[model samples]
Target: MTVTTRLAAAALLLLSLAGCEGMSRGQQRALSGGAIGAAGGAALGALTGGSALTGALLGGAGGAAIGAITR
Candidate 1:
């Protein structure tokens, strides 16, 4: 995988770890979704030769929305 994808995945994994520490359900969902989305977007972007930052932003937004709605 590319640098952007790697970075994003690392970030997502780290955030996921927070959920194990007794964080609020909403907070955990939001964080998890945002992280996953960012990583997914970055991976997709890297494959398509797109901008990592843009992918991250869009992913974060989408994730946030999904997370909020889920809770």
Candidate 2:
């Protein structure tokens, strides 16, 4: 895999562990979703000639929605 993918995966793993360790459900979901969204955005951005900042903003907004709706 590429360096970006590797780093994203590592970040996700760490976030997962953090989620499992005493974090409230809302906080965990928000954090996890944000991380996932940012990673996904970065990947998609590179592929679609979009700005990473735009991707990240969109991702974070979507993540917040998902997180809020989950619990």
Candidate 3:
């Protein structure tokens, strides 16, 4: 990927992580999990030539569900 793409992804990840300031523990966990999963999925999708958006959506949903179920 180009430098610009990498930078954009980094910015997006940072922005996602910055939104958990006033949330409950479970809400924070779910948001954190979803952000991490989406970043991972987007990176994998970029490397594998798949749809990053689809991967992000799927990963975010799965992560949120798991986070919600864990405690």
Cand. 3 TM to true fold: 0.66
TM per candidate: 0.65, 0.62, 0.66
lDDT of candidate 3 at residue 22, scale 0 to 100:
78
Task: Give the alpha-carbon lDDT of every model.
Answer: 0.84, 0.81, 0.84
Cα RMSD (angstroms) for every candidate in the order listed: 6.4, 5.1, 4.8
Pairs in clash, predicted candidate 2: none
- Top model number, TM-score: 3
lDDT by residue for model 2 over 3-67, one digit each (tens)?
A: 99999999998986865788778878887788788778877887899888788878877886798
Q: Candidate 3, residues 1-71: lDDT per residue as tens digits?
A: 99999999999989976777779889888877887888888888878999999888888888887777777
* Candidate 3, residue 25: lDDT: 89
| Model 1 global lDDT (CA atoms, 0 to 1) | 0.84
Candidate 1 lDDT, 1-71, residue by residue in tens: 99999999999989967656987889778877888888888877778899988888888879877986795
